[model samples]
Target: MSLRWRITLAIALVSTLVALALSLTVHFAYAYRQAEQARQLQTQRLELALEEYDRTGQPGLRSQLNDPKLPDRLREAASEGGTAAMVTQTPQGAVVWAALSTTGGDTLSLRSSYQPQLDDRASLDRVLLMGAAALIATGTGAGVVIGARLSRRLRHAAAAAARVADGDYSTRVSAAVGGRSRDEAAELAQAVDAMSSALQNRLQAERQVTADIAHELRTPLTGLTTAAELLPEGRSTELVRGRIAVLRDLVEDVLEVARLDTATELPELSDIAVGDFVTRRVATYSSEPEVRVATETVVATDPRRLERVLANLVSNAYNHGRPPVVVEVDGPRVRVRDHGPGFPDEVLAEGPGRFRKGSGGGHGLGLTIAVGQARVLGARLSFTNADADGGAVAVLELPVSEGEDAPGR
Candidate 1:
């Protein structure tokens, strides 16, 4: 059951048990009081009966003893030489009877009918029962009200959490949900709000630094590349030019990654055949990699970003793993796998992050950029070691396209 129902039932049960205990206490106390009053009246009647027995002797006493006014229980007590008392319900309401033996051979008995004490006790029982019912009803109502309020507050917190998980750093638990209440739920809301704020600030700072670094490196890199090109043609000059080109590419990649981080690079989605797209992207690679088209399917995606993702995967495979680098498209998904000592355990387990690369790996932003681009397109990018070939595989599952035509159509 939900928290609301659990709390409601718990409160009702506890309140009912408490009410029952109190009602029982009152009921027993009233009964005891009525019994004491009956005993006292019986004692007085016994004294009066003994006096009458001494004065009138057996004849008048016998008539009094056999009086119809007395109850059966009292008559028995008086005739036998012992004490007895009983309360019985009659058409005229409840009556109390008591009897005792006198010093003489006769017995004394008393019948107190229309006794409010006994009758009041019965009335009190009805009141107690009614009061208990009222208390349980009141408690259950209160519990439901309190539980619903608490559940709403908890749901608000949960919604805020979901927004944050979806990369919406601007979302926060609102003050109206609690309105300055310093309860535990309020504390949780406060904590989530603080966490989202901190993440937004941190990401903003990281994005700024990345943009600044990339901007700062571009001018010097251009000058270096021009200076290298102007040098005399020789082995040394060739090495220098190649190194400058690598540095230029690195700076460009950094800027691209920064753009991806800030979500500034919006995908220009278009309808394209999955097989043709993968084939065209793989054809650009210098390695002339093999391609497998398992099924012809169309997809809606940003051609430029998708090509960039495929290019990076192909480059990483050739640079870091044994070739026969293959690109495979099955339906709306593509896989780039290389027959090399798969991905290092750490990278596969912890996922690809900026500056986290394996031995002999490029500047670690490649896979990170791929992941960001995949996320922007509402796709899933996953890395795993292939089971049969024991090679690293990067699988990108793209969003479904609007078109359903086959490839080359």
Candidate 2:
């Protein structure tokens, strides 16, 4: 539940409990007080009656017992409508003989007048009433203070979250209950801030990479267009042709990276002979011969994405490897090894952290694009320097599917 609502609920519950306690105390206390008052008042009436009886010893005084309307008066007072009672004994010896009708049912009458004394007050209504009021008031006050503090904390956290949502990652809530601990709200606020900060950093890095790619593509494009002006005729023309091909490769890599980076498409999967797939990729990219052997290797994978991955890896190796790219297939596994100067230490350390090339030539997004395509096809990509003597090894493991790679599944 929201903190605001919880705090409000807590306040309401405390108030209800306090009110109930007070009501019970008031009811019990009023009853006790009414009972005490009736008894005291009855005692006073009894003393006067006894005195009257002592003064007029006619003995026929039983009929005119000092009070003709005493029973009705006592009954009226006792039936105060708040506390029920009987007119009970007044504790005077011989006072009963002086009495006439005991409408109080004779159970409350005394024999003769005795010395007046205070009754035991073991259960004082006043003390109980005061105690209940004090306890309830104190408890309610404490609850109010706690709820207020909790609400304040929630408000602070809510404001911080709103600021973060508005793209302000620097926003933070204070971890204080008048300067103490940062509760659950504060922790959540802090987490949101951290996540926004990290996302912002990543976006900035992507922007930089985008800018670099645009600049690199522009130069190659201009060169290819400028060289196209010279007609295809001799050795110089052949050089221009090679340059044109390189420019095309660069353009294709750039487009591939763009697609990989923002792919909103899933791969079409199929069960393909892994060895044959490897042979096709090797033949497509490698000028040097490639080898493929069939094994119990079958994988459900998108052929096009797999092809792209193999093409990129092989092209990368051909550009840098010494010669001879070897392709091998195992159970749901494929490996491409190059007899090149392996991979640069820099490339190995960074591991597909886009736009880092050691040869100082490639678009550098080739391996990154390949890796992304592999991921979309539910595949794995790995790279390692083959031997201590230097050469690059690439592993691509694709999951086998039951159908052919095609459009619309």
Candidate 3:
């Protein structure tokens, strides 16, 4: 359940429990007080009847004993005990008090019919019902209002967190509540804002360092390549040339990654047939991935960047996997599967990272670059092990270009 409902439910339950406790307390207290007052009044009436009997020396002197208003219980009390009192309900739901006493060996009885006046029990029940309803309404309203307010604030914090996760380092939680009232939630918002600022600073610093290193290495790297080309044709010269090429490529890849981190490499989106793009890119590789196109669709993406992504994936498969790299295009989605040992547990779990190589050769920026380009294209890139064979399967889901036919399932 959402936070709003959870908190509201808790408040409602507590309110009900408190109301029930108080209602029971009031009910019991009123019953006890009424019982005590009835007992004292009955005792006084019985004492007066006994005094009248003592002075008159005649049972008939107290005419109420003979009257029809007297209850049968009072007559029974007079016959059974010399002194006693009782409150009882009659067959018609009427309440009565009965008492018996003796004076000069003459039995005397007393009674008083109980009929509520202004403080009738039925009217009290109506009042109690209204009060309970008002209490519940007030408590429920307060819970909803409070729960909604808290939910709004928490949702704002959660949205800011989501934006930060989505690579929007500029996103920060607003600490508006701090100025008026600094509650726990406001403190949490402040903390989130601080964390976002820290992340932005650290990531920007890292990107700047990478860009600086790449820029510094390029001048010497070009000079070294030119020197290697001038060297006489020999084993040593060939080895040096090869190593220089590798170093140059590494520098270039680092600069590209730094650009991606800074989001300076925006996609030049264009309409390209998904099937054709897959076929042409696969042809560039020597391993020649098996291509399958079922229900082709067009995608809007930067062709060069898309080619780069395909090249890196195919290269990884050929170098690391066993054999038979298969590339399948279904609608706007492409899948590359290799029949080899699957991706490393860490890569599959933690996702690809720059400089973090898998169990393969070469610098680890290939998958990282691919992922970054995919983001620029507003597409999704995922890696998983094939269900049947435990081989790495990379899927790229691209957004459909405008005015293109919708992709079939």
lDDT on C-alpha atoms for all candidate structures: 0.79, 0.63, 0.78
Q: Estimate each model's TM-score.
A: 0.75, 0.46, 0.88
Output the worst ten-in-a-row residue range by lDDT, candidate 3.
58-67
**Each prediction's number of clashing residue pairs:** 0, 14, 0
Tell me, by TM-score, which candidate is best: 3
lDDT of 2 by residue, 1-409 (tens): 6655566667667766776677677766765665566556545554555455556643231334334334454445433432122433453421222122233323122232222321223244446556766766676677667777778877776776677654455565443223456666566656766777787678657855764785678786777677676676888887777777777776666656655655455898777767776766666542845676746565677888888887878778777786777777775677878787887776677677666765637757778888888878878888899766568988887765555332222
Best-matching candidate per lDDT: 1
Clashing pairs in 3: none
Candidate 2 local lDDT, residue 279: 68
Error of 1 at 96 (Å): 7.5
lDDT score of residue 91 within candidate 3: 66
Residue-level lDDT tens digits of model 3 in 70-119 = 55666666667665556666665545454564634344555555556224
Q: Which segments of model 3 are wrong by more than 4 Å?
A: 59-100, 105-107, 113-119, 175-179
lDDT of 3 at 135: 78
TM-score of 1: 0.75
